[model samples]
Target chain A: MNARRLAEEIFVPHRLVMIAVAIGLLVWAGMAMRWHWIPRYYDLALQGLWRTIWLLGLSCLFGFMLAVPLGLAQAAGPRILAAPARAFCTVIRGTPILLQLWLIYYGIGSLFPQFPWIRESELWPYLRQAWPYALLALTLSFAGYEGEVMRGAFKSVPGGQLEAARSMGMGRFAIFRRIWFPQALQRALPTLGGETVLQLKATPLVATITVIDIYAVSSRVRQDTFIIYEPLLLLALIYLVIAGALALAFKLLEQRFNRGMVG
Target chain B: MLDWLYALWPGLETSVGLLSLQPPGWGGNLLRGAVASLQIALGAFALGLVIGTFGALGKLHGGPVTRDLLSVYTVVVRAVPELILILILYYAGTDLLNQALQAMGRRPVEISGVVAGIAVLGIVQGAYATEVLRGAIQSVPRGQLEAARAYGMGSVQVLRRVTFPAMLPLALPGLSNLWLIATKDTALLAIVGFSELTLETRQAAGSTRAYFTFFLAAGAIYLTMTLVSARLFNWIEARYRRGQVRQ
Candidate 1:
């Protein structure tokens, strides 16, 4: 990426001082910062990190699955489907996801036990758990945001490709699977990556619902140990690392997508 | 609570009763929370815009150290989640201030939640706003800046009269998006037990056993704010866009 050359080009004298100051701060943090609690919480922190990752991954997967139909409905469906789809995206996008999370978890979660069949069902135990409600809210929130992105992606697809597919005897579903969906997905991929990081940021909201993700664990650490800065700083570093890796992965994915397409 | 209101309008007995502005009804509390949310959002947005303008300008026109420092701030703030940032910033900020006060032999003052919330969200908003404004400022036609200089205006004068206004139209959409983000981000303060709309709704719904009602009402309030803000931004954009190049 020519990072070395670029850094050399931009390395003015004051910038050097800035770099040195940053390094010094890190060193001070390492040498002088608190550390007595790490051994106790590290195990739980790891588990919390795992929970956060899975919540991010599964919800994004499920959400994108939901978004495809929502996007398609908004882009090309009849008024009946499109209006409701549009309304869903608008309402979801407008409100805070924290509100939505509480709505699903507390609002709908409280309602479930009121029904006799829900209590009697085999899935009742899972439904009674907090993670499912967390998952549901996260999934719906993702679907809402991505639905708008996908709508733009769908609308932006070259009309000629669809016309050509139709002339070649491709049915609507076949055309969608082959040319339409792929192109839309490729177009949506960049925004999808950015939104995924936002989803990662949002995974912490489950903590509010008592789902014990990484942020929740950190908060618990603070409550128990009466230490605040160390845990939160660690949490920030973890998030930064994950966000960086995710960014790099998306960059590679974008490169691959570009490679498969002829110029 | 809503005897007069119900008398004025029939068949709204239950749902309307839940939202009455009088005692035993939480509608007034929710509205107060909405006002608090708006205050925070508005204060944060203005503060962020100020920081963003400077950050963007520094990135664009300042020295290498300034650019690098601003970039670091933006990147770090953007990568981390706001909830974590709020937690860290809210406490750390207040603690640092008190320590500074103690060092100066002054008694530490309690930091108000609204002010702290504004400052924390403002910092977050500033990062996003910087990116938006930097792009917007860059989108200003270079020729316009040159022309202002051509007219014998000093650097500050050029920025005041030409660069800022020239960039407004291009920057409006991104800035507006950030405003909406600011409003939504205030809900994160609910974690810190700030009395914002989301937390207020939770308390109301918790007490009432009417979770769907209060939460949905809060949602509607947020939605309305967003739509209204969109309209307001559009009007501001149109106002600034008089007699400009259209394409």
Candidate 2:
């Protein structure tokens, strides 16, 4: 086929060109601001961005770790564990994450000082900080919502495959590892990507508790400079870059994992 | 022994550090806040339904430009932090409105916090709703439309009678999920000084120095709303699924 025809057949949009134009506009805006404004506030912005990444990364890591067991419990047949797990998921998923954050940061944080054991403990300092509470809230939020996604994925795995593995003299652990894990993870990948994006968005809520994430820095900048749109525009562009990168990364990872599977 | 009992009942309110949820106190404020939260959620959901319907229609049938424009809208809304979006919209919306008024030699007008809150939440929720509805509409079988057309039904008639009724069963589950999200998104409105549940709880907590009591009260109220809504949506889903064979 001719090059033009082949290009049409490939069904590629002008997305790369559009992305380039967006980046160019962002750079141009940055340079325009850098003459005086960005130089003065660059450190603050960078610090806030760093904190945002740290908050999101740690919460997502711990939350995903905690979510696996929660997800498993929901799918597990044993009523003893599953009932509580089900209730936990329902409560967490049902309520707003902001409410959860406030409940932890304000409600529990205030109550902590009253307990002599809690106050005297070595862990008291960490618990006293807003970041820890924010982390806890975000983690709980993730486990609640993402746990459901994973549970659904787990259920999607064909029972026949597990039965087949069992009949092959495979131990329960071996059967789960070989037959269930891969299929569930593969099924869960897309949903998990969306959840991670949401977790990233939720990172901004930490700022409400006075943790200086990117949104906090932008708010500070807006207040200090009294230039409402500039700081916000810059912050939005930064988020756009981060979100685009995340989406691209997830796409690549999905392709890598799905290799040799039916397209 | 009483101290130990107090520890178990931290917010019991019979003594120092006791939490209480009874009426004629913080409970009233918290419930009022819950009412405000529900109001905003309902308003936003209603607005989202309208925007989402048009958005889905545009994506499904409109020109390439409309599709690209809507794709950008969905992507940008989904990607951005909703809190940031609301803040930007709230501030910029006021500023622009004031500017326009100034140009017309009119007095500078303050945007109502409730209106701004509902508008921003509705706009954001609409993006997700669009995607949900688009998927739902697409899931309706093509044969149904063809069959309706064969009966000499017009496109609008088919859409009203056949297409809508068919898609509602598929769409209700997703729309209910969006409704839950809309309810939660209202909590973010508290950050902008909206007199919602979170803000009310904060005020009560700050003044009384009873952060634990008020926040916990607020959390319970929110949980009650969410759980009740979940049950309600499940009923609605069942109603929509009437006559359909279960899988």
Candidate 3:
């Protein structure tokens, strides 16, 4: 009758069966003739997996680096700077990442011919490459979202702790370095981890802009071989594995950071 | 300044021309595409809302068999990429269904772009919606439900009159956010050759090679829709909060 008892009774056995059935179905699917399509293009699939890793890793690194400064500024800077940064966050958050990608890759690229300055600029060569454009768009978009998370984390650091550091003759930068940063990082990790996983899923959108990520390669393989589901199913499996690893790493990090909290 | 203006004018003119609603203009195409996109998104959202509400309810109160099945459905849909889902549904959904139906001695059926888009997006949205609805339902006060039971109200009566109303306030913000996501996701329907705004913009860009202008316009349109919806949601939130105060 109580909520806890009901939850335990209903959820425990159900979850076990769910896990078992999922694993059984996956193994059965793996062993079936349907998997023949995968072996024929094993090399391509591997290449696709490699590309997915590379893109997600580089994009996340770039995005995190951009996010930190932007977030800090948005939180602590003068209104003039913070207002625009806030607006940037709002606009980016409000729209679709797909349109952002298209705007940068095809939309901006198409302007090069008309803008003589852009055409002649040294950056044009780099901008012409699809990967850079995809990377740039992804970085900017993630920066907007992660900036908000970081701001929330920074704000969550207790005022009393900050004052204590200040009273100990710690300068603003030193106080931030020694106290604020670590605490904020710890508080922000879970949300950041979730966002990173979401970003990993978003890597496939780069395929639309012709980045040849895993999804692109899978589609190419499907097109070349006329095997529809196999390549996609394999790609989905690889994504699941990557997401599982990320989730595990985040859990470990959370546990390590969670020490001394309760006491 | 005049020279800069002159240089930009031609491309801008062409873009505006393309987006015009007049015959032989690309604006008409984009408008039609926007309508199709809206239809798919709205249809998907409606279906997803239904599935999500039921799924959340089932996960909360259903038997073990139902709970496990719903959880599996949610997890798989959440894990799989939206684009992959769209591709699978476009390519295999109708065929698989037709094969099963034929074995049942029913005629084979073709799934249209609209139907496929709605089905795929609905399934995907339903995954997130289940979480949203479940959280909202859980947030409703246990005391309220207990009070309803004290008054001899059955589960159905309590759900209809008390639980649903309380949950609506909590659920509206999340549902609006999901609606925006659904609208944006219809962009992926472009791969299936659905004549959504994104697809129309792509075609116009490809044909004219005025890609920058067209896409910028498309981006502006998308931003406008998002901004308007956000304001609308704010208004709804305020209205609901006022109603709560009166209650």
Model 1 scores what on Cα lDDT?
A: 0.93
lDDT of 2 by residue, A133-181 (tens): 9989999999888788778888899889888898999998898788787
Model 1 over residues A89-207: C-alpha lDDT tens digits?
A: 99999999999999999989999989999999999989989999999999999999999999999999999999999999999999999999999999999999999999999999999
lDDT string, candidate 1, B202-240, tens digits? 999998888888999999999999999999999999999
Question: Model 2, B24-92: lDDT tens per residue?
Answer: 466666777888889999999999999999999999998766787799999999999998899889988
* Per-residue lDDT over A47-138 for candidate 3, one digit per residue giving the tens place of the 0 to 100 score: 76787788778878888887777778787878888888788887777667887888788876666667888878998888777888888888
Candidate 2, residue B44: how far the Cα is off, in Å: 0.5
Native contacts recovered, each model: 0.84, 0.77, 0.59
Docking quality of model 3: it rates as medium
Clashing pairs in 2: B11-B18, B11-B19, B12-B19, B13-B18
lDDT of 1 at A43: 92
Off by over 4 Å in 2: A1-35, A115-121, B1-11, B15-24
lDDT of 1 at B134: 97
TM match of model 3 to true structure: 0.89
Compose the digit string of candidate 3's lDDT tens values, residues B1-247.
3557658675555555667789767777777877898899899999999989999999999997887788768877776678887887677788789999999999988778898899999989998899899999999999999999999999999999999988988999999988888888988888667889998888987887777767777777777777888799888877777657554
* Pairs in clash, predicted candidate 1: none
Best by lDDT: 1
Candidate 3 wrong stretches, greater than 4 Å: A1-24, A111-128, B1-14, B104-107, B243-247
